[model samples]
Target: MQMYNPEVLGVSLRHIQNRQERRVCEVMTAELADDEDFCGCTLCIEDVYACAMSRLRAHYLHRVSIVLKRPPPNDLEIREEVCAAIEVVRLRPNHASVT
Candidate 1:
């Protein structure tokens, strides 16, 4: 989870936060702006959000490559599946929501 670029994950998490409820990705894929760091520009906010959506799509389908360098093992995969897209939901203070 910590493996992907921070800009990608941070923006995605923020987008999920704006949604109606907690979500877990069935697939997750990361996308970048054709122009580097275009995500930082307010004018391209929608583009940034779309990039995040791309990542979310990748996870829901169980192809979580955005934040992982290699495929995860069974236990980790199960964990990701169970906990995917949890950004929209707040967890207990001790729960570290974004594991």
Candidate 2:
């Protein structure tokens, strides 16, 4: 039996990351920037980020991969997820209201 070693294959395991993360962050940033009412506290922001990431399908990839054959999620879809996440966090924020 042979054990799989990414290092031997010239690929680092740490290089693996969800491709959707970048898109999600971009969309979320835009959405948040436009909404002045949304909480800007650390906890609220973190919660919204986590919630949005959870709802979207993860497209993981190795940094070494040259091409991504599959198309990424639609822009509208990502916006919808980020919007919903913001609403969820706003309605039931974990931390108390901050002055």
lDDT (0 to 1) per candidate: 0.32, 0.83
Residue 33 displacement (Å), model 1 = 18
Score every model by TM-score.
0.19, 0.76
Model 2 agreement with the true structure over 1-99: per-residue lDDT tens digits: 586545647656756777778888898888888788898788888898899889988777865665767666788988899899999998899998777
Q: Model 2: runs farther than 4 Å from truth?
A: 1-11, 63-71
Task: Kindly give the number of clashing pairs for every candidate.
Answer: 15, 0
In terms of TM-score, which candidate is strongest?
A: 2
